[model samples]
Target: MKTTFISTQAVSSATRLSIMKMQAELAKNSKELGSGRWADVGLELGNKTGRTVSLRQDFARLDSIKDTNGLVMSRLDGSQAALEGMLKMAQDFSASLIGVRTGDTGADVIQDDAKNNLQALIASLNTSIDGEYLFAGIDTDVRPVTDYYATPVVPGTGPKAAVDDAFLTAFGMAQNDPAVINITPAAMDAFLNGAFAAMFDPAAWTDPTTGWSSASDQNVRSRISTSELVDTSANANEAAFRKIAMAYTMVTEFASSNLSEGAYQTVIDKAAEIVGEAISSTTVVMARLGTAQERVKNANDRMDVQMKILNTHINDLELVDPYEAQTRVTALETQLDMAYALTARAQQLSLLNYL
Candidate 1:
């Protein structure tokens, strides 16, 4: 074996290098011990870094979806509540129409109530959540229903106008005319179930030069999850709303003096029929909303579970065993102390000091 002699300068340099390395290890272990995760994940994970990055990206995307799903759930809840309110109003109005005397002075009171209910129904249909109109379909910025009190002066311009035109064209009378009692089921059929009904159709909405026009894009949809898109809102363009509005219009206009008692009763009966049908249709829409809300809730549940699993995976990749890290930190502290002691000793071993 050949004998090797190392110079004092070389020994000092080597000692300094060893102490620096020990200090680096001490810092890393201390950080891991305090944080319970790897301080340098890339260094620790190496080839697995890509997988960790990908998992985090997935988490971010999922979190974003969950946020959107929460908003959608809120919108659905609001829509359901509004529809329920409208249905209740319609039900009450229908129940009031029963067995009413044609000469009842309460017609004014009832008409007043009908106007209030109509306004409330419009308010409900125009419900907004977080500043977005839930019933406005894709046109969230536009209100879905124009105020019912607006005169139908411009034919074919708005809901009130559409309704007024249908009545004038069908019955040869203004909507308030007592002769509306002459409107047979055949005449009311078109208003209730035919072309006039189609006017309330989402597809029939045209670009009126003004406020919300009935456009075919009525149902509002939201992506609840990566793989799922759901219709989260119902628009006001459904037949139910039109039926209610028309009935309300007729009832609010009804006065005992406008017609013979028999004719007034006939109008009341027709209003009842229309409002009843509106109630049924509103119920159906509520049922559909219930189903949609349930689907969104289920998706949220699924995402919650997936998020837990993903967190676990992320922890496995990036977290350190707390106990092990503490032990390593203590060991590194001891090694660092020993290296400092050795370096101090090395500084004293210079050849010039020996001289």
Candidate 2:
């Protein structure tokens, strides 16, 4: 028959091309397995690896967020501690006043104790973490109290017998009214010591001459409940009244023995009442601090949750799948072997069979 012989070369070439295409596909899927996502090569025919990659990245982010939660919790813990200290100190002072003997010795002893407690209290207010003051109200950059001099309690060094005005400044509050002590600390000390001239000492506290206006420093931190933030020119209101209400009671009650039941006797009771209110207000302050601590903890938890979701996503996107990769490798190896054997067999073929 007059017919052209078709070459085995053509058949083998077509088979090789088909095998190569399948091989390429297998390799791509294998990569996606190891990478935990499809690696789209932009070949017009295939690519679906985007989702896995995105999820894997998310997983990584979640892990980072979880780490941050620990730090946030630690900070909240510290803040809670500071607030508790303030409450405890205030409580003890109140209890002492409530149980005051109203005698000179009793008042004097109580005043001495108060002075020590106030020093400790101011130290607590200046508590800091990472060099940031916690009780500085809004002015955390500075210490809530200062050692302006070796003896801040000394007259002329600053206000006498008063919470260090420097402490007020550190918290960024203004006390332009320099007459805070009403009597120099030295003279007040002499009076407390029972010196006869203490009554006439210019430095000594005279209830009549001493200013009682809420504007005076005697009531500066009155509003100093936990939530009370003292600011520059912050009006002395119920807040400042709350802060020194206890101090007012101690001062007046001790002086009560000196003053007979007269016009100012009622004033002493009023001062005592004010101090009692301050103690009540301190309880409210503790509650507010507790709230702040809770809020900070909550915020940290939310961040942690978000991070977890991200971590899972990142893992899915980035990691390799051993089973799928192994399957692809095996399948591709088999196809390669089959194609090589077919090519070898084709090369040996010729027209010998036909002859």
lDDT digits (tens) for residues 105-197 of candidate 2 = 554556566666555654555567777555444444545444212353435433232333322433233223333324333433333333321
Per-residue alpha-carbon lDDT of model 1 for 1-355, expressed as tens digits? Answer: 9988887678889988887887888888888888888999999999999999999998888899999888888888888888878888888888777746455665666777788987897788778887888777788877777776776567556656655676677668885676755655444544555645465444554435223344235587788888998887777667777678768866765433455566556567778888888988989889998999999889989998888899999999999999898888888888878878887887778667667
Q: How many clashes does each candidate structure show, in the order listed?
A: 3, 26
Can you give the TM-score per candidate against the true fold?
0.78, 0.49
Using TM-score as the measure, the top candidate is 1
Score each candidate by Cα lDDT.
0.75, 0.48
TM-score of 1: 0.78
For model 1, the stretches where C-alpha displacement exceeds 4 angstroms are: 1-20, 99-101, 150-216, 254-256, 337-355
Candidate 1 residue pairs in backbone clash: 202-215, 202-216, 205-214
Give the C-alpha miss distance for residue 30 in model 2, angstroms. Answer: 13
